[model samples]
Target: MENRWFAYLIPPFIVTLLLVAGSQFVFIQNSFYQDLGLGRTGTDLTLVNYIKFFTDSFYLKTFWITIKVSAIAALLTLFLGFPIAYVVARMKSRLAMFLLAGIVVSTFVTIVIKVFGLIIIFSADGVINKTLLNLGLIERAYSIIGTQEGVVIGLMHFTIGFSVLLLYSVVVTVPPSLEYAAQIHGASRLRVYQRVIIPLCAPGFVVGGLMIFNMCMGAFTSAALLGGGRVLTLPVLVQRTVMMEVKYSTAASIAFVLLVSVILINLFSLIAIRRLRSARLVVA
Candidate 1:
């Protein structure tokens, strides 16, 4: 019975593998062709699209901007989420469950709605600007729309709940007795967190950071809405290349480059983290 139940998983797994791998192969294969405009691709395979992506300053800048925003957003999300997760995880009251449920629901909310809420709050005549103006914090109303800062904020809003959930799970895994022991040994509260909690959660942090970074990298609705068409990330560039420019081949090449870059970065990051852990073990 158990064997028969396990067998049910294989068909869906194969179907998923075929759908995902098959589509990716088809899409990436188109990158080798040249764009002839009007949604048409040249019959002859060429490296022109890739070459153009590398040579063009605009594309390079967009790629860097994407990385920068994603990295910043991921780091910020981790920082902001850690404290909330810690507090919630340590809570003895039922409120903790409520908080977690709230976070989960908010996280799953549609990005379009979230972006619009951000816009409302950050608009020139919105609550934030009005409060700042009233408090004499600024002479004029400033906007984050069309700015890199806005994009970063959008990304953070998108990923903060996930970060909290990830860190919360990590925090819970750390035995409370360890924190008590550290405190009993004359360690301060801060010291307990620094020496006991953080060290144990390092692996979780790396994994969570990378997951958030990957999400930010591929995020389209948040970037598009927050950026206001000024700040162009790789995903946005790919969309424009395909939809506006009608250059399918170039878009495919850009998409391929983005995909490869994310995979390589993640691979290198994990390898580097492993080396660091090994070094620490050797030192100990």
Candidate 2:
């Protein structure tokens, strides 16, 4: 307790210093050079690599795609996670533990396995295809693979479990009596959720949202395997840049920009949470 103020920020300050130094070292050493078609190191320093990224439509398109995918994934996780969290938090018993365990296990299931499962269920000549054919719902097999829909669905499956768990933990911490009081005041079940539980769980949702958003932004493996390279996200583009051109500098630049964007998103979420806390305190 003697150095309480020191205890408040010294850890994060140390971490920030180390992170900034390391990132700067990497960026400076790698970024000032040119990628001579195969990254053989050109004779002179040129800003052309960075310039190309901004000017080229292909990279610009990839940036837009990346943002779109991340936004959809974050929102999907929020909606899918909120109700599951509400139920798990309100329902007290060993069943809650069992459900929590299921979510934990589901969260770690490899994307490849998930995509394979979806293929079995959603592929051409798969269950839906066959069922629809037999029932005359559709005249032909619907191709769902290697599509944006596939990528979005896969990302939702990949992210929702952790979101549910994080929000569940926060929801369970909310005092039960508050909800009971609202109910006594004639608030409907849904109204209680909207007015009371959501605000209480806002901080946890922000944490989970940032996590999902950042992961979705850099999501390479899932989008690659599931979307089958049809989806051109920023991470996929970065990988292709490195592989096709062997251009570390260009790749590093894109990656640095991506990391900076993710940091800003997290920072914004933290500020939003603080604002929400201030509003809640004002109401109390």
Candidate 3:
């Protein structure tokens, strides 16, 4: 019976592989051809699109901006989420479940609704600006729309809940007795967290940070709505290249570049982390 049940998984697994990896393979393969405008491609394979992306200042700037915003948002999300996750994970009452459920529900809410909510709050006549204006905080209203800051904020909002959930799981895995022992040994609360909790959670932190970074890199709705067309990330550029410019080959090349960059960064990060761990072990 167990063998029969295991057999049932193979078909869906194959289908998923075909739909996901197969499509990506086909898309990336198109990048080798030259774009001839209007969704057309040259018959001969060439590296012109990739070369143009590398040579053009605009494309390079957009690529860097995407990495910048994603990195900033991922780091910020981890910082903001850690405290909330710690508090919830350490809770003794049923309220912890309620809080986790709330976070889960809010995280799953549609991105369109969330983006519009941000726009309303940040608009010139909106609550934040009005309150700041009334308090004489500034001479004029400040807007995040069409700004890199806005994109970062949007990305943070999108990933914060996930970060909290990820960190919560990590935090819970750490035995409470270790924290108690640290405190009993004359360690301060901050010291307990710094010395006992953080080091143990380092692996989880790297994995969670990478996951959040990857999400921010591929995010489109939040970037599009918050950026207000002023900031262009690689995903946004890919969309414009395919839709507005009608250059499928160019868009494919851009997509391929984004994919490769993400993979390379992740690989380097994991390598650096492993080296650091090895050095720490040697020192100990």
Better of 1 and 2 by lDDT: 1
TM-score per candidate, chains pooled: 0.95, 0.83, 0.95
lDDT of each: 0.94, 0.80, 0.94
* lDDT by residue (tens digit), candidate 2, 1-284: 76897797988998998899877776655766776657665567787777888899988887787888788988888888888988888886889999999999978888778767877788887988999999999998987668887777777777888789888887888999999998999999889877887767767777778888887888887777667778777787778878986887888777767777778878987877688678764222
Question: What is the lDDT, from 0 to 100, of the residue 210 in candidate 3?
Answer: 100
Q: lDDT tens digits, residues 98-122, model 3?
A: 9999999999999889989999999
Task: Give the residue spans of candidate 2 off by over 4 A.
Answer: 1-24, 43-45, 134-137, 272-284
**Candidate 1, 61-151: lDDT as tens digits:** 9999999999999999999999999999999999999999999999999999999999999999999999999999999999999999999
Which segments of candidate 3 are over 4 A away from where they belong? 1-14, 281-284
Clash list (residue pairs), candidate 3: none
Query: Which pairs of residues have clashing backbones in candidate 1?
Result: none
Which ranges in model 1 have alpha carbons more than 4 Å from their true place?
Answer: 1-15, 281-284
Worst-scoring 10-residue span by lDDT in model 2? 275-284
